[model samples]
Target: MKEIQQFFIRNFIAVPVSFGSWLYLLFGIGMNIFPATGLFIVLYLGSSFSIKQIQLSSNLKQLGMTRSEYKHIKNQLTSARFKVKQLNSFYGKVRSVQAFRQLHEINTISRKILGIVKTNPKKFYYVEKFFYAHLDSAVELTSKYSMLVNQPLKDKDLKITLQNTRETLVDVNKQLEQDLRNVLSSDLEKLQMEIDFVGVTMNRDKPVLEMKGDKYNDRK
Candidate 1:
């Protein structure tokens, strides 16, 4: 939602301002329409990009992160998101109900984790294992399992490998759940802190609030 808001804000700030310059160049100075349009495109793109970067820097500062840290986390998140999309390709490749269910669980958990971090990039530090390790494991092992499951005639070795892959996917699923738990635990901690703060505020201000009741409460 914040990202969507930023998109609109960037365009709103950059578009008409850039277009005004274009209007001046084409009409005020009577420059050729073609060159003026070209310059307008360039100016619009540059200003839009600059505004986005400024917003990003400001947000990163508020998050107490350096630009380098933000880029690192964002890169990992982009990679992980791409890999999650790849998981969809396996749905048609998988056969058994168990295999499909396992893949679905992993994909669902991964997306939820990624959604949380993408919304609050600072949480990446708390759940690095999902982006760094377990997600890769889930994608790679699922691919391998799909291939093995598709074999026309499986030898005893192939069957054992399939079992091992399934077991590994189970572990991956659990780790994804753990990563989610870690992220949610952070949210839970923040919520508890807020609740504690509200309790304190009520206790400390109750008398004053009662004394001043109906004074300024409804106006604001």
Candidate 2:
């Protein structure tokens, strides 16, 4: 229907009038009658206005809807991005201790990977060694930094780091699920569990929000 509308808009003058005007144009304008021309017009009009036209229009509307959905997703992405950055900054403030640094490095990498997952989830589905293959240095540095913060386990500092890590981990899981959906890889289930474990370790105190989204979208 849109195509037909567009065609009419583009070639408005080319659309023929009724049969009476055809006769007038034929005689008055000294035009030659072409049988094939009339046949083409009949075929084009019949097809353009048929049920198939409705289906095509519906499909185009769905495309528009999907584009809008993508925009909503972008908003979620922006929020996730800010959270990840906050986690990174928190990681950097930890004192320099080897064990704490190791833990920090892991946590940082996890957070960064979560960001990437949020931005381009298809990467998670395609890459075999996803975490290792796409390891960012910033992630590594942050992980090490986080670990360093945990060394002496000062009650106040440990409590704060735990809160930060928990928040970061929640964002990570949300991003991963968004980006890595419907993957055929066998490791997907295990990956989800591992992410959950990380979250549980970081926040033994807080309640985790169970996602209410559809497990499978009919149109995805």
lDDT by residue (174-204, candidate 1, tens digit) is: 9999999998997899999999999999898
RMSD of 1: 7.4
Model 1, position 188, has a per-residue lDDT of 96
Estimate the TM-score of every prediction: 0.85, 0.27
* Residue-by-residue lDDT tens digits, candidate 2, 79-145: 4455446545654466536434543554555555555545454334343233332233334445644
lDDT of each: 0.91, 0.51
Residue 59 lDDT in candidate 1: 92
The alpha-carbon lDDT assigned to residue 54 of candidate 2 equals 57
Best by TM-score: 1
Q: Which residue runs does candidate 1 get wrong by more than 4 Å?
A: 194-220
lDDT of 1: 0.91
